[model samples]
Target chain A: MDKRKDAGSWNRHKIQAVWALLTNSYLIGFAQGRIYKGSLKNLCLPGLSCYSCPGAVGSCPIGAMQAVIGSWNFKFPFYVAGFLLFAGALMGRFVCGYLCPFGLFQDLLHKIPFPKKIKTFPADALLRKLKYVILAVFVVLLPMVVVDILGQGAPYFCKLICPAGTLEGGLPLVLLNESMRSAIGWLYVWKNALLLLTIVASVLIYRPFCKYICPLGAVYSAFNSVAVFRYQLDQEACIGCGACAASCEMQVDLIKHINSPECIRCGACKRACPVGAIHFRQAGKSRQSNTTGL
Target chain B: MKRQLQSSKAGILLALAGLLMAGVGMHRGEMSTVFEKAVKICMECIGIG
Candidate 1:
């Protein structure tokens, strides 16, 4: 099995998960049950790390985008949008594959030694498009149009969705302070329900929220084709055996959809390629460009 | 193949332009609001507000 081979060699995904934890470790705040209030908070992380997490030192980009869009000052989210584009161009969904804590959670859950492993169903492909719709409707349009008397729009996704917020921020804070428990309302209950659903689904499906509902992943997916860090396919070396395509958990056909929006750049295909025909290289390199089909 | 190459070039240009726009916005103190928002506990983010 590829898993045995992966263990014999270097495991890139494990190393990446370690890196993600170290980068976001503002550990003192979690110990004290208080979120960090520091200058670093002004900057958005490349991944969907929650801002309200007690241990989080950096801001979540999607949260910052919604906050900007929903503000009373009602200006375009130039900074957030620009940051997203820059990050997308730099690495595409590499952040989702390696840097995101929520994505890591899903990955770990899917590894839980269940008797039966869940495979992608027929509807899974169609459902993957739902994240894009959520990006358009909740993250972009709703935040701009749904306004209050003060001309401030609600952060609709954070309030109504975002299981990360519920798990990282709400649960911890409530458990830490019993007084806060008395203030729990319908929104809290709804959020908890969403969190419960996401937790259950992650065990049975690979990155359920990322595949069907993450607005940030949707934004980054668009840049997969042209991101500076990208996958290179050596067409000459490939035998059209379809091994790389079959290895993809996201169901991407690596030959035809080498840099498809669905790819998270997790390097699974690179490991799975028997002939070493697939690997990551600089996008603008002349040799790499000559080899790429797309 | 030519069309794909052209699109890739366009994507690079678009990214560069986006980074420039982000720089301009940051210089204009747009980041101040992000700082303000970050300092406080976002009640809505926790699903209570």
Candidate 2:
């Protein structure tokens, strides 16, 4: 553990921890079976904090959307969809960059003392499209098409795929309640296996789930180019050097696709740029912000 | 820059329309239903269902 870097050194990580803590403030019920039946539960947080977590005081937008779609009435999820669209249009994958609790979880795990860090592989570009596929199939189409005799469809992604649901909600609840352990079945076993694999993979790879799996990230990425909060490459100052791309873990070519959908707006490229060529810019503003130092 | 400017305006307008729809949904009591579900343990979400 001595070989590990000091977590306190990274200001971004500290900010991320603060955000995660602020969003999950119902710590009094952290180990409890009863969920907080508060008015705050009606609102959706901008990140992937599982609704089933005892400390969770708000609905996960994705889970909320799935629930709405899976209801017996099969009503349209206007609020959830609109919330996602509005958030995407406003901040793009900045939500993932700055707010997502699951993103922070993977980030901290990757910081653990590994002998060698893995670089972005060639297949990553192709595999990143999988999240969009998941969004289309599991999140949207499956719920819309497949319904039980009672006209209620299952929340397929949450039930089958989401490792966050397994880790944050399942593991904690099952561990705390003796009664829940007996009820666990093969599906629980399968989810645990998936969660374990994802945990191990996070240590080896940078944001493996966010890069290839999270449907929310896929949805937000669609708005990357048009989102109000954005980054600009001052072509005039840029010398076409590859320094920015060299430091970017997301495999984004900073000089080429300055606002690439794959980019989380993590500001790594901006920090790496030698000539201060990259900076933050809002959509309507004529002048860029002094966020290059960030 | 012109194209980006136009897209920005479009994005803002779309967000406003989304906000309106979300408001309508809230008025229709979707918020209460969402809260009702959120307060539950959601066994299916944890793969126990």
Best by lDDT: 2
Task: After the best TM-score superposition of candidate 1, give how far the Cα of residue A67 lies from its true spot, in angstroms.
Answer: 0.7
C-alpha lDDT values of all predictions: 0.79, 0.81
The segments of candidate 1 whose C-alpha lies over 4 angstroms from its true place after superposition are A1-5, A8-10, A286-294, B1-11
- How do the residues B1-49 of candidate 1 rate in per-residue lDDT, one tens digit apiece? 4644565576687789779978876876767777777767778888888
In model 2, the Cα lDDT at residue A140 comes to 80
Return the interface RMSD of the candidates, in order shown, one decimal each.
1.7, 1.3
Model 1 score (lDDT): 0.79
lDDT of 1 by residue, A263-288 (tens): 98777776677787876755345332
Share of native interface contacts present in candidate 1 = 0.56
Residue A54, candidate 1: C-alpha displacement in angstroms:
0.3
List the lowest-lDDT window of 10 residues for candidate 2 chain A. A1-10
> Model 2 lDDT vs. the true structure?
0.81
* Stretches of candidate 2 exceeding 4 Å from the true structure: A1-9, A286-294
TM-score of 2: 0.93
Which of the CAPRI classes, incorrect, acceptable, medium or high, describes model 2?
medium
